[model samples]
Target: MRVVADWARQESWGVRLEWGLAGARALGPGSACVVVVDVLSFTTSVSVAVERGTRVLPYPWRDGGAAEFAAQRGAVVAVGRRSVSEQQPWSLSPAGLRRAPAAERLVLPSPNGSAISAAVDGVPVIAGCLRNATAVAGWIVRQGWGTVRQPVSVVAAGEHWPGEDLLRPAIEDWVGAGAIVAALARSGAGPLSPEAAAAMAGSVGITDIPTLIADCASGRELADSGFAGDVAVATELDVSAVVPVLTNGAFDDAR
Candidate 1:
């Protein structure tokens, strides 16, 4: 299978775009898995929720007007942020979500992550982050979907335009994607693209892991907003075995 890594919409080739509801609409249906990466926190949040055994209903902040739509269907609604802040209602950590009652719905508002989830349509969607990289990759490989025919697209939910200097979010995603690529390679799946190879190679040699990512643009923004802990929480690898699969506008554990 071919792994296409899109840094952003405008920077993507063949089929890729930056984070937006519009970019998500362009996703075509094929034997492909859409791996959405909002590593700074959103994907991290979804991964946590799945790990805790709660069904997540991801909606665009605007469509939150329809939150009742999901609640009626027995799913919890989570809204993220448009900017960084620790005061947000739900924490992006597994322990936090686990502490909440299963019947409770979480409304989240995030700058980038939720918007990307809202935009995608059709195809099997999966949440991506360093914390769940191995589980996700192993699941994909076990599906036995042969390469060259089955395509895997890793979408990076980057910051809004003009605020693109936040390298942490993208770097976190690249590292996660690299880890996935490496896992796929071990299965003798296929060859890695130069970008994927670089991501894998780049994840090495960071003395202070938390500080390395926290210093990135997104990390700094979160830190300044008092959500620095979220960045540190988001960057950890394999914290949970949950693999959240986007099915019909809600997130369910990938069996």
Candidate 2:
């Protein structure tokens, strides 16, 4: 950590693509921005909500109080994948959120993405995914983050195995993070670490994102859970202009 912390401070626009909370710490307090990529649902859900003119509050999934937290914030809570129905408009299902009526504010609790985003304290956190990767990168550039000075950290919110305390590498979040990395590289926004560079290279061959993601382990798991549509929505590239910026503990459209 001392080595990583030292490395982060050396560059004018240093960026290290890392997973979970460790990534946030590596970038330290001087980071221009922290982009949280949870492509399977969380960041994609943020895109949908922000596009619909709703602010999303990323609440970490705790014991079962997300509903109460939602009530406290005067926002609707998103249910689990299987618990969603027409009446429960807000849910983790990206497809369901797209079709359901939008609430002015949505409180979404997730074990992966939301938790990672919430853990990154004292930094500007923005949700990014395939749907708004380019736009998010563009916004970062426009704001002079990782451009004129300061650094940015792209945090990939990887999936945790069932009943396990460790995270399994997820292809979807990797690819999603790569999408943003590639965009940032093209803009010459900052210096990319080897891991971020490799991620960008991996994304270069993705000619058919939806097809590839459809067969990934997470995709298959979601399909088994009757949420295949969520995968499809997550693969939509550069179609959304909304960049969900988190400030004061809520995500609203950056534009």
Candidate 3:
């Protein structure tokens, strides 16, 4: 199967473009695998959780329905937010998430990532970030072994939309996506779409990975809000090889 670079560019290929998580969620259930990218940190959080051996339960930021669902499944609920508010000093950590009681949960209300997951319910969802890009790509390739087609959608959780400024988010997500595409190509999965190829090429210009991340809109927002360290940590690739797979609305290691 072919890959769609950004949702916006999917229209010509008869693929629907999902603007935000809401749009993504509208794409009902199927055999497709939705890969969500919140390059700034949320995706990083999922990678971290998987690496630490904690299962991730994703939900829509606006709706808390996933929280109850996770509780029923005996998984922790994690929250994602555009910026950390006073109410949420620490977004759930991988270690803390692992310690959550069976009936307990971590709620994620991040700016971009969590919403991406909420949009595509019932579809096999995977978390993607620069840090875990290679691992996740490897997992996808393995999953596609012997299959005629692998339906995969890479959702770029760009910065808050309609703001018009996209330099940081664009650069961050393009780089992350590029790494994944490279990994997939290396696995003999075939070539990426032209847009994907361009993104991969663009990632090379980011000489200072950490600095680039920190300067991103989301990164700057997080840093200004006291989450600067998180930005740096998020930019690191392959820090953890855990590939988080979303099953029935929760994220678990893809054993």
Candidate 4:
């Protein structure tokens, strides 16, 4: 297991890319920062919440435990998209969070992005989305991460199959991660692993990112369920200057 893990680490490269919670774990150790991307929503929602002055806590599950977790921290727990109401507008939907009143703190739970964020330890965890990709990359470069001595890992939080833990690699997340990787490269971060390079290449020629995101499987899933607004919010590329960085188990604006 150790041998397999070491081989998968991509440790020789300054920038590495991998998928889901397990990917976060594999690349987390010794890395200076781990960036988690979930465009069709978790990271996107985090960007919105943090931009609104909310400290976002990444909780791994949306189960009842999330309520207790939020209670312990005196924070509100964001509900599922379908569970959102006028009285409980805070949800994983970026659109919902955009319209919700500003919160001092929020416990945002999800199986993908939030789970990956919660799983990474001993390094800075950054929330990266289309909205803040350039900001995130600039922050990472400024911190002198993504070098041979201090590597950076970008983890794509792909969706899980309904009623199962099986991961379905969502294209929106791939491109979202790609946006960060590409930005990092442009910011002078180097020696990208093949996986990271592939992710960067994946985002390269995306002329109409909003339309691409809206037509993707994950985007369509949200759109078909009457949450098209969420997709719209997630596709606002480079519009945000807030860099949400996890410190003390909560994500807040770093710049």
Best by the lDDT measure: 4
Candidate 4: which pairs clash? none
The candidates, ranked best first by lDDT, are 4, 2, 3, 1
**What is the TM-score (0 to 1) of candidate 4?**
0.97
* TM-score (all chains, Cα) for each model: 0.74, 0.93, 0.74, 0.97
C-alpha RMSD for every candidate: 5.7, 2.1, 5.6, 1.3
Q: Give the per-residue lDDT of model 2 (tens digit) for 92-187.
A: 888988888988989989988898887877878999999998899989888877642567788888988898878888999899999999998777
Q: How far is candidate 3 from the true structure (C-alpha RMSD, Å)?
A: 5.6
Ranking by TM-score: 4, 2, 1, 3
Better of 2 and 3 by lDDT: 2
Superposed model 4: Cα runs more than 4 Å off:
1-4
Q: Which of the two candidates, 2 or 4, achieves a greater TM-score against the reference? A: 4
User: How many angstroms is residue 166 displaced in model 1 relative to the true structure, after the best TM-score fit?
Assistant: 12
Q: Count the backbone clashes (under 3 Å) in each candidate.
A: 18, 0, 22, 0
lDDT of 1: 0.59
Evaluate all candidate structures by whole-model CA lDDT and list the values in order: 0.59, 0.84, 0.60, 0.90
Candidate 1 structure quality by residue, lDDT tens digits, 64-134: 46457655766444434332234433544433454555434454445566666655666777787878877
**Model 3 residue 177 CA deviation in Å:** 1.7
- Indicate the residue-level lDDT of 199 in model 1: 54
* TM-score: model 1 vs. ground truth: 0.74
